[model samples]
Target: MEVTIIEDQFILKTKVFFNNQSLQYLKKITGSRALIVSDSIMETLGYLQEVIDYLQESGITSTVFTGVRPDPDVSIIADGLKLYRESGADVLVAIGGGSAIDTAKGILYFERKFESTEGKEMPKPLFIAIPSTSGTGSEVTDFSVITSEGEKVVIIDEFIAPDIAILDSTCIQHVPQRVVADTGIDVLVHAIEAYVSTKATDFTDALCEKSIKLIFENLETFFKDSKNTQARDRVLNASCIAGMAFTNTGLGINHSLAHAFGGTFHISHGRSNALLLDAVIEFNANLGGSADGYAADRYAKLAEVLKLPARTRREGTVNFMLALKRLKKSLKVEDNIRSLGINQSEFEDALEQLAETALLDRCTPTNPRQPSKQDLIRIYQKCY
Candidate 1:
């Protein structure tokens, strides 16, 4: 018997604060100046001013950069970097969804990269992430995806992970129902992908299992009643836990396809993932032509963990894929890219390029089943 020694190393460097009033913890950090990165909607919703008020109450001066946009691009990051450089802030705070946090990480990343190239030293700011949505988990992950020149560029490095993650369900209480459903499904995809990833270990598996169960139990309640405090908190925590797991285990073709498709169609990231998830699951579970059974076995294991009815591995795999589709339907997510209002002719024209981009995505390497461009294209077509 060849025994595989799986070295279990679980590292989570970010200090997490989870509670109803977790933003108050910012007062404990001894920084005199703070810079907040967010978007216009946050500003309009008064979240921006609320954070600024909190900093002021803590005796810290603050600057606001509200230029982040959906599917943020290099230019958005450059703008944020310029604001941070001029703010004279010792602490950086990101408030909003993944785009805001990703922009903040991008600013810090490029600043360090540029400084290193110039042989100059710059003090790193203390980074804090306050996610207003219960998805993406960008707050605790060593990853940031920024669009540039018609491509979604994924940046992964320990340096980009926030120093602290503050999870307060109150922040997400006002999120639109549609957004709630979209982001909630995103949490499920994160957990499922992390659980089945080739890099998954015992630690990540535990976190993924817990996260998945939480989403399944709480997402529907949270979506229907955003004011349900317990449901909101559970879903929020699940998002962060999933983020932590995927940061270590990495994601799969689902994320790769989402990134590419979102970049091309300008679709919301979470919604894009929701649309393609069922197709990707079926693709990963298929044991056709040189296919390894690792992913299929993992999917079956997940179904078992969820206590879905199954008599064997094949039944479990089928049940797992069906469960995902049923969940999407319950959440009111579209079943295909065509339903998302994408022009069929344009989608067909872009399929090859999208497939190529997905094949090169950073998340693709850790996927249990490696996919070729043609394989990715076929998946895209099926989803279409």
Candidate 2:
């Protein structure tokens, strides 16, 4: 199956490889020279070398850039661009977690942006994303989050989406329990947010529902036993499914809040999203509000998909929220931002700024409920 999105004169399409050794096919599609974008950890895990060996066997010369950091900023992009230019590679391969993929996207995005300004025509490199972690799903999404001036900036364009996504579970077999939990919850949040997004269509809804079910059924097993190949594959596929869903439908305020809070506090993106999920869900439902009940009805439909008991829409929404809380607890994720160990005074000082920044986040537009700054503040406080 394939999905296509047409927005503002751009067409976005991604090809996914599931449970297959995608590297075997790399030779068939790649250019003669490849620029590998990753972090040091990928090197330590030997995954980087494995990729290099595959490329070499395919007669594709490759150079390495391992400077990507968590919540990468513009500086990382600058560094990567320098490496990309020096390598003179015609293919760009991102291997590692979301950070690496996002860094590669940043490099490509800024390069294109610069070329446009200079009125110089530069062909985009063949971009392939190999996710070593089952989170973020950056491999299939047209969105990249780059932190600049203490804000997580969202860059969206069809050009940022990778030409191919390699979803081999072998790459994630060594993921730590903490990351498994964090990224797993990220998949769930991505699914829920996309399912409730204002832009959701029947296609996105189906993908989101399937992704949510996969996470619920597989995350725990994968967390408990990282070597469980079946569980790992399921979760990895779920992450990609969620990624494809959100890329088309867009995410909601849960991601908006996460981007703001994470950029401000240096929290992991998935952890930030996990902490804020329940609060955002409740806010979006607006059970007692006089506004349109569409979001609430959607929430109930999701509950039905999950087989959660509900006598009414409100009851289903509440039950779904409870289920999420329970899942977080089982995964050992923190229930609230306060529990993540930010200083109370620091949090208080940053509350208003965070709320305001969240309101400006790109993900906010498709949120089922429009939120005032005060509303965001209250939600942050409630989570805190």
TM-score of each: 0.96, 0.95
lDDT of 2 by residue, 1-384 (tens): 798876522234778888847656675765799999999988998889888888888789999999999889999899999999999999999999999999999999999889999999779888999999998888999999998987899999888899998888988988888999989999998999899888888888888999999998999999999888899999999999899888988898899998999888888889999988877877888855632377888888888988998778888898888888888999999878888889888998998999989999899999988999998988888889
Off by over 4 Å in 2: 1-12, 288-292
Q: Rate the local accuracy (lDDT) of all candidates.
A: 0.90, 0.88
Residue-level lDDT tens digits of model 1 in 38-151: 988888888788888888888889999999988788998999999888988899999999999999999999999999999998788899999999999999999999988978
How far residue 163's Cα lies from its native spot in candidate 2, in Å, is 0.3
RMSD of each: 2.7, 3.5
Worst 10 residues of 2 by lDDT: 5-14
Shift of residue 222 alpha carbon in model 1, Å: 1.0
Error of 1 at 50 (Å): 2.1
Candidate 2 Cα deviation (angstroms), residue 287 = 3.0
